[model samples]
Target: MRILLLGAYGFIGLAVARRLQQAGHDIVGFGRDLDLGQRLAPDLTWTGTDLSRLSSEASWQPYLDGIDAVVNAAGALQDGARDQLAASQQRAISALIAACEARGIRTFIQISVPGADPAAKIAFLRTKGEADSALQRSALDWIILKPGLVIGANAYGGTALLRMIAAFPLVQVLAFGKSRVQTVAVDDLADAVDACLAGEVPKRATFDLLAAEPHTLRDLILKLRRWLGLPTPTATFDLPAPMASGLARLADLAGWFGWRSPLRSSALDILSRGIVGDPTPWREATGRDLVELDVLLSRLPSTRQERIFARSQLVLPGLVLTLASFWLLSGLIGLWQWREAVAILPPSISHGLAASFVILGSLADIAIGIGFLFRRWLIRAALAAIAVSLVYLAAGTVLAPSLWGDPLGPLVKILPATALAVAVMAIAEER
Candidate 1:
């Protein structure tokens, strides 16, 4: 089939694209990032198209001229007041369904969430349900697959969160810890879509996709920890609902900067309701069971990449925050205690030069602290921090070597901090 796959570089989109390509289907990939689309399907043509830009009145006439089917997999966790979720899941979907109807293209595949309902209070699920209803209302031969928690080899938002939590050294704490979810392997979901396209499964139907087994959120996380070869958590604690909600609120604040938290308010709301689906239809349609979590885990790549990601997840934040706090405080100390800071300098270093050092060094530290929060430029920030540390180390050694042997080990600590900065720099690259 000549398919136009939206969100072609996303976690689900990548898996679906690969499965379709492996099955020898022609996939015309569309996504927010054309480079990512090209990377995901190097052999295919890619169009940089943001579904969030699509509107009900927009014309997508010619885009579907040669497409035999359309797969809508694009999504976002939070809208961030941008209305991006509605744009992608509702308006854009309605537009596409209408256009496909005009062109007499019947096959439409919708990747939906497990608990989506048009009447639901949650905007995410409501938007999904609205689109699902649209597809069903249209004359197109639509297939809707609503999967529960999707666990794939690739570590993305939710997957990354799972690994990061599982990698915790000891006690595992969470909110909504007892919520049950049935996870579906991304590959299995991809295969199901492929089967539907091949007419092996019914068209104009909806199926709830999930594995045979169900697990509580806590058990699921522990299972992942075991899969990663991490020791089982010594204990698991569910934070009070109020505390969890507070954290989610903080996450929402982070969303203002385009940084999404998998544990945001909307996400916590969804988790509280549980991520679950009936799997009987999926099994009956496929005539086989989906891959077990253990099997999927074993098939996943557990190499240096995962280990590094897990380790970095555990340490990178502490390193950045510690450095930020230290630098910001150090600058304050220098500025607030100008005389003490300057007095430590050699007599050859005039008071004017010493004041300049105190002011500029403090400002530099503050700037680097701010830079650590931006992922796009995080590597450069870490490198800049390392440079500053080395400069401080070298200058301190030359200026007053006595500080190196100080009881607090203030100067010696820079050596390790520099090393950590290097590590953070290595892991901060866009993955």
Candidate 2:
């Protein structure tokens, strides 16, 4: 089957795309970044489609051509000027439904979430409910999956936030941490989509894809901590709702720095409401029991690689910013204090060499700093940064040996810089 998988670079969409490909289906991916889709899923065809502009079927036609079925796994938790949930999750999805109907495509799968209702207090749930409702009203055959707390190896959004919280040395829980929640593995959720595509599940049905057992949010965090090989949080903070929301706003402000923190105000609102769901429909659809949370976590890569990826979600960004600071600061110093920057040059080197080292090297640092900000080339930039760090170490050692004994240990700092570069490279590795 030819499948058009939107959000193909996303956590769930990537898993489903892989599953569908393994099942011998040709896939065309639709997402915001085609470059990211290619790097993440090299074998799958991908196209960049701005869903906000897809106000009607005509806007979706270019993507729906030669597509036999469609899977919409794209969604958002918060609204920014650039990425509004109403467009990405609701309105554009309705447009895609219309296009699919026009193309005579009968099969569609929507990756939704629990507590999706038009009357919901949270905007995320309201938008998702609206989208799900639109799909149900469509004449095309549709399967809506409402999964609760999707757990995946590649952390993003809620999953990423969970891993980060789990990776912390200390455990922290909200005062209302007992809020009931269910978790489903990414593979399991993707498999549910595959089941729909393969005709192994009931047609035109909505199902909650979740584990057999549900746990309190606190218990879930503890389980995740154990999964990450961390001791149970000795000191857990029972954060009040108002306090947590305030902290979430701070995290939201950091979003301007390029990391979308999942602990949004709406996240707390929904968490307070709980995320449990019925699993009987899931059992009936797959003709098998859903994987329990314990089993699901056990199968994940808990060793070095997985742990690095999980912990480095926050670490990598900090490292990149730190790296950027060093480069940009160095550039500013060279441009502002060219005399002092040049004085570090060896006595044997020509004045010309010293001038080139000051100006050209500073410009290189600034350029590398700018490159680090782009996600598409982050890995490559990290690699370049590693090389640059090494070059700086070797050059400083040869040219400014006396500076090594300086109070700040400027030369000694290269060791951590190199390590940070290597770490970012490892984290950003596409594989």
Candidate 3:
């Protein structure tokens, strides 16, 4: 089979693509970033297609050619700077279904969620539900697999959040701790896709791929802690609902800046409601049980790199915020004391030249600070910070060399700030 896999570079999609390839299927991958998709799975053919832009059957034709079956793993949590849920999830699927029908391609596999409903209160679930319903009504042989919280070797979205919280030292702070969640290993989800493609599962059916039983969100975190080989925390704090909601709102605001924080309101809403579903349908169909939570965690490698990622993610937001705040304040203070800044230059320099340098440097600092607030601009911001800091250091060394050895160490402090910017640039790219 020559399969066209959408969102082929994503956590779930990549896993499925590899599984299919191992099963001797010729895989053609499609994603928003063609280069990234190719880089992630170099052996597979890849095409760049923004599903949000393909809301009509005509728009899907170019990529659908020579495709025998289609597996849609593409999805967005909510509408934000980089996503349009309705267009990508609902309208595009509808158009794809129509295109597939017109082209006489029947087999379709849809990856969905447990609580998906066309009339659901949350837009993420609603959009997904609308797409699922559309597939159900279409003439194609479609199978929908809605998995619970998917745990994998590499962390992303919900899994990343779990690892981050579990990595905290000596204390555990949790929100929606009592909410129930079933776990599904990413490999198991990939197996479900393989089953669908191999005609091992019934067509025109919906299956919830998950563990045999569910665990509380709190219990799940503890399991993650143990999985990460970390010592148990001495204290556990359950955050109040209002405080959690406030944090989620802040994450919602971050989404507009292209940061896909796991605490976004859409994610919180889903978590608060609980993630659970029956595994009986899928198990009965495949004649096998999904790996239990304990076994799932044990199978995934827990190495030094995973520990580092968890701890780093826990501090990432605060680090970015502190860096941005420092730069902004530095700029604002320089502007507020314009005369003092001008006076700091060498006595040999003209007053106008000193003032011009002060004003431009301060404004550059302000711009870099503002740039750090947007995830899309984070790399550029970090690079700019490094460049500007170097310029300041060079100018300070020539103009006021004594300041480097002064009590305040004003010129010396720039070293750490420049190093911090370089570190941010290193880890800012999202997988």
Tens digits of per-residue lDDT for model 2 on 35-139? Answer: 888888899998866777787888888887788999989887877534677877788998889889998999999999999987877889999999899999999
Across 1-431, the per-residue lDDT of candidate 3 in tens digits comes to 99989888998999999899899999999899988877778998988677889999989998888999999998888778998899999999899999999999999999999999999999999999999999999999999999999999977888898899899989988999999999999999998899899999999999999998899999999989988989989998899999999999998999998899988999989999999999998878889799999988878899998898998898888889978998899999889998998887887889998898898888988989999999988988999999999988998998899898899999999999999888887766578
lDDT of each: 0.80, 0.81, 0.91
TM-score, ranked from best to worst: 3, 1, 2
By summed lDDT, the worst window of 10 consecutive residues in model 1 runs over: 254-263
TM-scores for every predicted model: 0.86, 0.81, 0.98
| Candidate 3 clashes between residue pairs 3 or more apart in a chain or in different chains | none
> Could you tell me how far off, in angstroms, the CA of residue 115 lies in candidate 3 after the best superposition?
0.5
